[model samples]
Target: MSLAEAPFVGNASARRVHGFAAGSTALLVGDPADGSHLAEAVAELGLVPQSVSGGSAGDVLARLAREAAALATSGAAVPLTVFAADLRVSAVALLDLVDRPSARTSVAIAGPHEIAKDPSAFTLIRVERTQRLVHSVGSARHVVSAPNALAVGALLVAPEDVPAAAQLWAAAADDPWVDPALDPFDLALVALVRGGVSVSSVPLGPYDVRRGAGVTVGAAGSPWQQRLYGASRGDDGFFSTFAVRPLSRRLTAFGLAHGWSPNVVTVTSLGLGVLAALLTATESRAAWVAAAVLLLSALVVDCVDGEIARFSRRFSALGAWLDAVGDRVKEYALLAAVAWVSVRRGEPAWLLATTAMALTTMRHLEDGAYMDRTATSRSHLVPDRLDLGPARDLGPADAPTSLPGAVSRRASAVSWAKRVAHMPIAERYLVLALGLLTGSTQVVLWAITLTVAGALVWSQGGRTVKALLGSDGYERDARRVDGRWSDLDHETDLGPLARGAGRIAPLPFTASVVGVGMVAVCAWFIDTGRLPRVAVVLAVLAALVVGAGCRPSIEHRLGWQVPAALWGAESLLVLGVAATLPGGGQWCAYAYLAAVAWHRYDVLYRLRDTGSPSASWVTAVTLGVDGRWVLLAFLVATGASMQSALAWAAVLLTLVYGAESAAHWRAWLGREGALRSEVARREAEV
Candidate 1:
């Protein structure tokens, strides 16, 4: 393996580092007895630190500047981050300096002023890189030092700042007043301050400390890591306060000293979670408690992975996807166990468990769809949950926030039951724990099933009722309000679909799922032979969208516009026919399908992306008649023995997709939906 890609292990005396984007930028470690202190700190922040040892600061700067200049000439570039390497310093504080969005020539710690030679003198903090010096710091507080002050040692010199920074280094030698062999701070003093440069003082509170392991491990309140623990907690409940957060913090401490990476921690948690699933399946009383304990441990470990990533600056694309997929895997595995137990107990509770599983997948699908729409439109601080990319990949999206500090402490639930239910991981595990302990897994399933089904229905239903009652124009710009994400139509899009047949461009992932899913469902329908040959042939045609949709002959001529919609429509119609032929409460099937389809349509209308609000809204409402829900509904319809009735309902509902798809093609092809593109263009211009 390349040295850069080699796994890091805890070796107290070794210099640890992570390099990025290839050309070298030296790490100027200020202390050696400290054992690559700055280098390790830099590495923790996901950057490789280089050993920069020269006789003096001037010598070091001269060398690095020359190298940078050489690279510039060769069409390559290397930017440098210099650290003081002091044990008293916290690496967390250097993050802003590293990623500082400033256009400054050079940055250094707002050092103690020369005139403030005595302890009582003002620090003379000057910041030229940002407007914060003028915008935030009040006229009254400039000279006076605050109580929780940080000693700054980090400096960032962006590539644009290199030429001027290099000039300062060269000029320092000729200036007789400035020492030739200068220290880093002294160089900052002359090269920046004396040279009429601007410098800003970063918050010192969570960044600097008294040198000792105890300084970090001492009080739960002293170190940045401890502060991070508090910051990382979601607006959660008792389990989060008493169980998850506390345990996670302690594990954070353990991981830091041992130099554990986020992926390693995540894998460990997954293993424990899997073991818990196994034990829960055993259905023994003692095993139940242990399963709960293991399950809880897995959660804490799951949380720890994120904590360590934030702490050590090791956030990676893999960590993002792993964190998400790992939870889904663990949750579903436990649910599968619950289902198995339900089946063995001769309880229909297995159905509820499976329903929860299906709902979870659907929930993520919608969330993924939402993220895809906003992917490049805004820069996210915590990143979209589905964005499986490195932190650096984030670009200016007209919006951003750091994830750790995102949750509001004021966020709360009204009742205890609701609070527990709202606690996400804590609640999930607590419920699982209680169910296993009480040997009343069915009760938990009942609660979860009701909750999931109710939420899916109520939230969207309520929004629809509200929208109908207090109607808003589909052309309204949701981005005008901070509540854009929560707006019913934020995630759905009409785009080219309804605009003119802008083409039924399902995201690649969604398309794959739809296609493969149809093939599997069609295969089952054919093998059952319960279907007529005509119906079976229709099912094959539906599967053709997935099975042969990729073939050039089919894709080029038909594309996905017609055939894909036909597949969704035909499949639903066949199922609905089969379901309703026996006529047992087929109206329920109609209502259910309508509710789901209307939900998607409502969302798509607000986000039709067309210029004419009326056209966009009407077209989206007409074109977004979804039958995908029939896929899940059919499972229940068939299982419930209301076959013919629901089957006929499915056929009626099937027309939604066909009409919607045709409408989308006609609208988009007719250029009626072209307004959506114009809207984006206007937004870009803004």
Candidate 2:
């Protein structure tokens, strides 16, 4: 038999009772303690009491409903009872079984105190129609129970003095347990349960206990969980949101209008540099002024191009590479013009040598360290990562994604220097004015070129070095796998120079050599009638000794032996020139100047063209040693001469030309060397 058919038993004098009959059940509801006592009294009746905790509102309702339904459907001819201590459960879940046609369910309210506290509770029980099993057996006028002594006592009281149950209920409503302020829905549910209304078993409308707390109770099959905590989510949306700014917008617009491609700007700057050099070679003040303007304009354009590319989001690797290469070329051209001027002025050799060394060092430092194609090689001035936080928060909706957020701070020294160089035109023009006041227009031009060239060199050089060698010294973490210093063989061809002397134009080349020969012959012509023949011999010997001694690798191998020989030779030339007549003296000076210029040009060109160690050696010697000595000599000579002003002018011009020429000649030599090597190897193999 089903458990619902089980028998029920309880004390006859108890405030409540329960039993089961065929297809029906009865429930006696009352105070919880009294209900338990009644159940114990029913031990002889063969019924067991089972209690379940009603921890939450939902739990309580569900429990009440299940117990009520089982009792209503039982087929056994027995009675079962359910007792609840409180009306916490809603009326619906408790009374759902009353509608069943196959069973009868009854509810009876016990305990006078309980009935008075909640009059509606009593009304709900009275409305239900299964067998009423009221232990009190009270009439509407005067309620009575198994012990009638109390009722008889109440019946003797004066009618007007009789305490109404409503008054007791009103007083009890003040009690916390009989909360009158309970939610209306909860109150209604309690009333239905008490009234024994058969509730239809509609599924619980989604349980939402956390609704008042503003917490969403997600459905079992919902995707909210995935959205809140999921992997493989991209940050594209975040970055795009960050990229919107007024400055960025303005820069982008300007970039588009200016047609300022980074690479184009770089190449243009290089062309301007070449033009500047060519103009400077004319030795005219107007030409110098023009060259200065062109150089300045080129620099301005160069600065704008990068700014445009960065702001407009059009930056590219090739453009950056070209910009770097172009800067080197520009410097070379400008300096080469200065060197050509030195050749015309007959300056001493040491000045050119110093300039060459300085340029080479600066360029190498920049190229090797800053732009070495490795992250480690990149300069510390620029950050490896871009800072996109501000942009992300305020960027346009459709901005490009995948932007990094670790931009270099703008306060780096290199950045500051660049800003200074690219300041407003007014400031730069002011600098130009100052240069003009301090020196000749030509001097100002050289100064301007040198200043710009120096600034560029420092900026790029520092950056390149940092890039090649990481701040932390981690070789494996280098950015480029195949940089300039990498072990892999990466030979660069120097184009036309590699074809050798055969391919060179006969007239111009021959003219240059012939010019040197003529100058030498002129030296002999001046020497015969002026100073002694011995002095002439000594001067020629000095040129040979000093020129050959300047080669570093050879000197290093030969120790100080070459230097001593050159010193002896120079002593003789100085004594010989001092003793010569004025006419011969000039010619002697001119001769020595020619020899120095020719030797310098030849050494630089050969080294650059052939990639010979000797070329580098010569360059180092001339720039570091000979160049400084020549400057000193010019200073001394000017200080002692009656034509000091002329001498000074001559010296300044010589310094400018010597420095520039040495640099260009070296570059040419390097290029030529590579070209020659390529042609020789190719031809020999063929």
Candidate 3:
């Protein structure tokens, strides 16, 4: 063996290893050292690694296999986790990775981009899970016909596979590369794959100490260092994804070393977040930009608070509860101020603003309540950042920070989910900043309204059905693995015609569209001058239908009772507001705007989910891709004077709309001898 491998190999016979204790999952620590940075991190998660040592990786495995079997339940595979003295990982993220469906020996490795600059890449070998092939962000570089190779760092092993691992480890140790030069991480990968183990990239961000430089527990000045410190698995927000995590982690890292607490960071974030709202709620142009910048800082600060909590081990149940409450308070203050600005502008978008806030609160509380009861502590709900005081305060001891992920946490057992449909938090704030910059209160209302409505429906609809009907809904909606095509996949070779036919059209949503449209059209012809009033009335009706359809149809599809009566009551309230308004005739257009706003947003969300076969490039020019822009274009055509909306309209129609209409209309009118275009294209998916 080479010099690097000598120490571990030489002491093989002298190392002591043990089997697991009763009711205890084995955490086997290898390669002990004086400073236990990683060992302490493992301890933070309440798993103190049973101290074990063996001469080689094989000896280590042999010991674990010999000892742990009797501790677990009969016929159950005992959990076995191996940690090196150097790796830093999120304990919760590690749990998710180990629990996820995988091979007998599942390994997680650092990505090429994640490690900064390490050339000793680990080849990734993932076993094909389905007949449908994938080629998106992760799969594009996949090596077809053979296991793809990429660098990785950690392994999550099932104890039963120890014999296989040991054999491979011995083979790797004998290789020329293993003695002096090979990375222990890469060796693990080699042994697993050579032993015929399938592999995938580490789902969580795990630190690999094999690299010459590592992120210190304390921050100094390296940009990459700061970003990594603040970052975690499953923060898929825009600013949080890119900006906030990086900047905030840098500050948090520094403060942590200098003796700062999570409570201090939380208080600072609360103050800054509230100040940002008050600033944006003003009429000054500069203040709008300032508000955006300050809001960005507040988010960054908000992020740091969590990092401090997690890193310092000072997290508390009460602190987590308060942090959530503060977030809602800040958002509410911001929304209330924005609503005030809208009324001042004489546009009356504050009506939509108030409606958005109420619904947003509902979505927030629902996610929080569900997560508190079921999952481990971590903010797992997308757009679930709002606060409601304790509904049922279950102690989820200071949730860990999750790395960037597909969605916050899994959204119930409901499958066929459009995972990337949630709005980016940074995009939401940027839109608000844009609206403020241009003094367009309507834009701000539109942004907030769609976000609130979509998230509320998406989070609550299925869960409510599950509670009402329990396991019956799951059985009814579950699809078997028969020979029928069922997904809205972009990577498959399915023809456009076949793809279109397979679209997931929820029948209840389709019915609601008809119900709302028929009602609107009949009201429109009642009086010539009252056309605008009719449009406004119709818009509110449509918003309710579209928003309702988001989750309502799922209930109907599964043969569950939908709260149609609740919807009927909401309709009455919509009419009551319309009739009671002092300036009903003047602000009526905004009502249509609100309805269409929710509908158009849902359309973009659904089209992407439905897997329309149109070229992605075509999506930019297509009206069905996003409806809010259509409303903006219409507002401009109707002489909206909010900061050159007319100019924007002129540009859209002259440069884009005519050609788009020709493209879409020609397809509808049988360019290929097909005539499927309906009279109204209001809810068209493609």
Of the candidates numbered 2 and 3, which has the greater TM-score value?
3
**lDDT leaderboard ranking:** 1, 3, 2
> By the TM-score metric, which is better: model 1 or model 3?
1
Ten-residue stretch with the least lDDT total in model 2: 148-157
Root-mean-square deviation per candidate? 16.0, 37.5, 20.5
lDDT per residue for candidate 2 within 1-686, as digits (tens), equals 11122121111111011121212222222224323433332231224445534243333334444544454344333334343332222111122122111233233222222121223222111111111221121122112212110010000001121122112222223323333333222322232322323221111111111111112222222121111111111111211113212223333334445454556666876788678768766877677778767765555455545544432223343355456445545544555555555546664322332233233333333233222223322222211111111212122356333212333566444544454553222233334434433424345445544654565455554543643464423233234332232210111111121112213322222232232232233234333433334323433332223333222112121121222222222222332232333322232333333333333323223333333322223333333222322332333333444133223433544554456546754565576576546434433432
Off by over 4 Å in 2: 1-255, 258-264, 315-318, 348-361, 370-686
Candidate 3, residue 312: the lDDT equals 35
Question: What stretches of model 3 exceed 4 Å from their correct place?
Answer: 1-61, 70-80, 83-107, 112-208, 211-243, 254-271, 279-293, 309-332, 342-347, 352-423, 434-576, 583-686
Q: Give the per-residue lDDT of model 1 (tens digit) for 106-172.
A: 3333222211122121122323221322101101111211211222445555566556556655665
Per-candidate Cα lDDT values, in order, are 0.45, 0.33, 0.42
User: What's each prediction's TM-score?
Assistant: 0.46, 0.27, 0.43
Per-residue lDDT tens digits for candidate 3, residues 1-686, read: 11122212112111111122112243443554445544544443334466545465444544544444333334454445555444544343343334332225555544333544432333333322221111111111212122222333345556566555555555545544333332344335444544454433444344333422332122232322322342443545544556657677667756655666666777888898788788877867788778767766776777776676554333343345446555655665676667667667675654566566545543443343343223211212111111111221122335222222333345422332332234444445555656666656677778777865775566567566665566421322233232332221211212222223224432344544443453334233322324444444454444444333433213233222122212222323332333334332323323332332232222222233332323443333423211332233234235454234323433453344335424543553352232112211211311
Error of 2 at 653 (Å): 30
